[model samples]
Target: MTAGEDISVRRKKLRYRAWHRGTREMDLVLGPFADAHVESYDHAALDRLEALMSEEDPPLLKWVMGQETPPDNVDLAFLELVIADHHARLAK
Candidate 1:
């Protein structure tokens, strides 16, 4: 219904696993929250995520691969939550 919700739905439709073989690739493409678990995301959420991830060091690629955790940033946490929700929905 919302922009975030829309992104999540689209992500679910994508062949995420195929596109991202493991956490390494996921992190590079999706960022730290790549492994967080997204269930219902929308465009706005993704845009926010991109903005947040882009500003991080190691390119968030390392984080998604379990190499590290993002700094304590409110925006990052919020994006992670959205990504996690979308991942959950895709699992179903």
Candidate 2:
């Protein structure tokens, strides 16, 4: 989150960004993930989610979809959560 930003504001912004990514496919992936889980996320998790969303759409989408492994610098733990969330969503 940016300097002086309230945590609630940060979460709202993250949700908006997730749902409004330029690509519709990305919107579908990240939007629901943020909606389902962002309320329970702590500051560190929010930081990780923001980091994950910072990645470019194509590479990020590939990673989330398991089409490619994320690099070491990526937030692996959070990515795992998102992947699990995504699959759980699919199962439903």
Candidate 3:
């Protein structure tokens, strides 16, 4: 992000990107997580998430949904949080 970008502006853009990942499933997997966390995410966690976002959707979605095991580099802890948050949203 540019130095001029406000934190809220940056967070809004990140949320949009998360919701607009190339497929609907990916959008649902990540969009709400970004909405809930981006504003509060520290740079390191946000960087890790951004790196994960660059990964292909199929494998990443599978990892999030627990269909396929993620490689060691994938952040399972964070993915679990996303999954839990998604489930909670669904339960509401």
TM per candidate comes to 0.34, 0.89, 0.82
* Per-residue lDDT over 8-87 for candidate 1, one digit per residue giving the tens place of the 0 to 100 score: 66666442542453545443445324444444445666555555544544545444444666666536666466456545
* Leading candidate by lDDT: 2
Give lDDT tens digits, candidate 3, residues 1-92. 66436665766777899999999999987898898889887677777678778889999888777789989887777777877888898899
Worst window of 10 by summed lDDT in candidate 3:
1-10
Which is better, 1 or 3, measured by TM-score?
Answer: 3
Range of the 10 consecutive residues with the lowest summed lDDT in candidate 1: 13-22
User: Per-residue lDDT for 1-92 in model 2, tens only?
Assistant: 56546788988999999999999988988999999988888898899999999999998889988899999999898889888988898899
Regions more than 4 Å wrong, model 3: 1-9
What local lDDT score does residue 31 receive in model 2, on the 0 to 100 scale?
Answer: 96
Pairs of colliding residues, candidate 3: none
What overall lDDT, based on C-alpha atoms, would model 1 receive against the true structure? 0.51
Against the true structure, candidate 2 reaches a TM-score of 0.89
Off by over 4 Å in 1: 1-28, 31-44, 56-59, 74-92
